[model samples]
Target: MDIISCLPGHVIDRILSYLPIREAVRTSVLSKIWKNKWYTLPNLVFDKHGVSDVASEDSLVDKNKIVKIVDHVLLIHSGPINMFKFTEDDVIGEILVTDMDRWILHLTGRSIKELVLEFLTGEEEEEYYKYKIPWCLFSCQSLHRLTLQWCWLNPPKVFEGFRNLRSLDLNLVTVAQDAFENIVRDTSIVLKNISSRKGN
Candidate 1:
């Protein structure tokens, strides 16, 4: 009579993987078997508000809470993770950056295969916006897919050790065409595809 029992394991896994990490963790209450199943999911997607619901009009979600959730998930996760996606508002403060760096380092150590970092920038002058990609990501050997959105790179960041990389997507990010070209050209790994769209 269990609802989970009626679903195929792969189907259930796919459904659970799409849920935010917190909601996915909560699924453990369904049953003991379900609890273990959540830990085996190969994809990990995190959003700014995933760990905490509290945010002031001018503040971001708590960084400490995010670190705790990431640590807890990595601690219990079984099997190799396939993807890590992070989406955040562009107004990140100084304190949050430090915690975010730690979290990124943790994921890279796990040999993640795909990484998507999306920063949502509100209506603002292009000249006034800037973003720095954490360097730890460039060292991930297992990373095969990378996506960056609404981000800017100063002095530009170069990606290396991604021998398996096949796809790259950059959307609304400000980088010289040459720098962008250098990234794709240097890879020489038959980049499967590259796509970009201008930011409004």
Candidate 2:
């Protein structure tokens, strides 16, 4: 028996699920049966650096290629994803931000259960330019976990109607300490865990 045929479908799926999205998609070439498996893996991860070969901002062609790959993955994933992760290196630059927001909106509309965003921003006047956390996330009825790293939030507010949120992790995120406390207090019924590392 062929090695690919020997493994059960469920077994293969389980193994693919653990890999980063880029690698998982590549497994589709293994066989026709595996072609659509990546779209239904229940987890979506988008990292520009992970899918690109260029190591620096000097190459615009490489950057565009990476963005297109990400767009293709999101466009094909038709299932309700369990988690969505978007991470980019500090050197990737700002041109990709718009595409990132578009992907976040798409995932949030799918009722993603968990969302993790890690991005870098300029240090000078840091408080003035904060990453915008898509509002759709706050309205996601299925969202239970949220993690934001090296991000900034302006006018941070408690998710007024969210009743399913359970865990929140913030690393190097700039938010009013009092506002953060109030948001937790207001969501006390469903908010069980919170870990934060304040930014400068």
- Highest TM-score model number: 2
Candidate 2 is scored at a TM of 0.79
Which portions of model 1 show Cα errors greater than 4 Å? Answer: 1-8, 48-58, 61-64, 122-129, 154-161, 176-178, 186-200
User: Against the true structure, what is each candidate's TM-score?
Assistant: 0.72, 0.79
Q: Cα lDDT of all candidates, in order? A: 0.67, 0.68
lDDT of 1 by residue, 39-142 (tens): 88788877854654534454444545565677788788987888877776655556656766776788789888888877666455653444556777667768
Per-residue lDDT, model 2, residue 195, is 40
Which model scores highest in lDDT? 2
Which residue pairs in candidate 2 collide? Answer: none
Cα deviation of 93, candidate 2, in Å: 4.5
- Show model 2 residue runs off by greater than 4 Å: 52-62, 91-93, 121-124, 155-161, 176-178, 186-200
Model 1 local distance difference test score: 0.67
